[model samples]
Target: MFGAHLDGVSAGPGINDNGSGSATLLENALVLAQRNPTMTKRVRFAWWTDEEQGLNGSDFYVRSLSATQKSYIKGYYNFDMVASTNGGYFINRITSTTAAPLKAYWDSLNLQPEENVEGQGRSDDYSFQQAGIPTSGYAMGAGARKTTAQATKWGGTANSSYDPCYHRACDTTSNINATGLNRSADGVAYAIWNLAVAATPVPDDFSMAVSPASGSVQQGQSTTTTVSTAITNGSAQSVALSATGAPSGVTVTFTPASVQSGQSSTATLSVGSTATPGTYQITIVGTGVVTRTTTYTLTVTGTGGCNGGQLIVNGGFENGTSPWTGTTGAIGSPAGQTPHSGTRFAWLSGNGSSSTETLNQTVTIPAGCTSVTLRYWLHIDTAETTQVTQYDKFTVKVNNTVLTTLSNLNAAAGYVERSLNLGSYAGQQITLTFTGTEDYSLQTSFVLDDVTIQAG
Candidate 1:
């Protein structure tokens, strides 16, 4: 803005010459200050003290600022001689990205704004622009004549100075064009609001998730699952995929292993038949500008009673109790009075008073087995007068659950064949145990020959 004084001229009120620009700028500042608006950048308004003496006021202002202070100014916009009697809209010819908003504002109103071809470096904005700050402004014509084209567009008199009052005393209240001043004020507000405000930056980030996060697979087989990634904010970047905590014999791979942000990728998990049978937790990770993790659960089945034929390791005592564990009195396959399927049989004879003997074996029931049967030939001879009460006994168990108990008092004929239904324990791993006990009275004996478990 310029409030210059002409020492030699008598009618140098200078209202139209600079007062219009000064008033509009002050009004814009007042409205914004009253609202106490928050903006990313600071805005300051200035009114130059002299212009007729060669831009002295603006020159002195620029020279007073420090180099760091000057650099802080991003842009400068001058409003001088904006409202003229024959006013025509004009925008400063600023050749930079900052010029976009002003140009766009005019375009939005369907107004054809011209460049300041007449008064390029004749304003206060020139001072800041010279110090490397981006500068732009709007001006109604001064002493320059408006062309026929300008008259047609702005509805003004052609071939006449835009402001006839120029720097004369007549450049007072009567010299102002209300419509032109209002429109120019609006243009100033538009540029200030858009250019002075700072924009917030969005963070570059993404999220990850997996479908069917947990699953189960049978031994000797492989299973597959997927992992996906999605962008949350900012520009696209490559994201790499990986997996951890896979058990032995298991392999995990990602397809198109890396994907651009805002996009997704896939991962597959495979387990070999020889993979260990147990539960596992697998971690799937996505890494790039950002990182994320997810977990998956997988269970592998163990070998059991799936294959046909006898399931026990050594069904008959003819193998000398190779697969069975014995814990107590007189447990061995000694030459017996009778043999069930071989020349030798298992015998559990009382070792002393109040003593017990236990023999057990663990077996796996394979997959697809519906029913199981355990059959054996046994003999018991005890001196006890009563069954469990006198304490000379024999007992059988499956997986820690007692199945039967007997004593010689109720013993069967010399040698008896017994069978047990193991249908409920199908398709599982189980332990089978046999126990024999004797009281202080006398010794007792429990014998077994062929012991077989069959599954279908």
Candidate 2:
């Protein structure tokens, strides 16, 4: 494959064989200029000649260069017989330190691992490598037209060789084939750039944590919550965090003055002196799609020096509230038209016309009680053809503050079983004020059963 002879019997100009690589390099360089390649480290590209002449051209090029010029290069890549009908790349790392960046780059991309074989650096890289520089290169398969498999896969002749009329008397322009050229070009380009950018392709790893996975306390007594996260390789990253849905009288703030990526920092969540006690869902969202949430229980002790267990209005009375407000619409009960039992309570809304009536009642916890719970039934009651003017909703207030307002008297059914933090009302009387949203528009009375008072 030396200098090509037009009619053979002499050296032939192997333009297509290696000229392709040289031409490609020049074109690619121009393209790089257009691309505005930015590099904080360094950038280098080279074209080698006399590769068929025992790499003499590359050797002279390396020998003539100054030590500084040679030292500037960390690795070398030789392109020899890059377009041969059948030829393979080889590496030489004895004198030259191998360029490990390329291998690391390939590994990070999750690409297939390279198979180890001998015969490397049998090209221009040998000259630079002899002076101590890492090297790598590529090669083509033995002389043959496009492969049958290659043709099918890449739309090229399968049984034919890429360089059909390889280094022979017939090795003319006709021998050169463009089959799979685009694919080959693309593959090389992708690999080079992929390696080039692998330096900073991936961001650092991060982690977060919330202490006291779950906690419970009587309202009024402050509880300290801790926030923390781990930074594995976040050497230079910013981590910001914020929270919502926390109970009143509670203050949450991140420390180290700022929330950023790095080390375990301390952040304190302070439940204030006047916090309403209840099981609240607090969400803490981190930067860049990281999220975590915690459920905290703030139990408020009620008057009467008693704390009742959890309850559900229509959940079959696990914890009974007899005589307090039994939901049984039995004898003498003149509320909702629907048949009522202990397990089924009347949902109070204003939907009661003259025929339909809602059950309404109020309870007060003595000054000794810290909190109270009134569990009932609720649902979205959509007006049917019979009742057109939908009117039913209720507001609940503890002393003065409206804890929860219910418009849940709709067509769909929903269970109501919730707790309020009552630490603030300890020794202070609390009255649950239930006011009808509308005056008998639906039901004149709001019937809520299973009223339990947890008095301290």
- Highest-TM-score candidate: 1
- Name model 2 segments beyond 4 Å from true: 1-139, 142-208, 230-236, 285-370, 377-456
lDDT of 2 by residue, 1-456 (tens): 001111111222222333223344324433553443533334455566666577777788779978887777755654333343332221223222342433332233322223223335445666776876556543343354444544554344566654455555776544433322222333344335434533332345466666764455444444555566565442435666666766677665666534565444444556655655445566655563343333434343322333333322333332333332422342133343332345444444434553332222344333444444454443344343234443555565666578775542334443345455655654444555444454433343344444444333
Report the poorest 10 consecutive residues by lDDT, candidate 2.
1-10
- What does candidate 1's lDDT look like per residue over 206-247, in tens digits? 788888887766656666666776766555678888888988
Best by lDDT: 1
Cα-based lDDT for every prediction = 0.69, 0.44
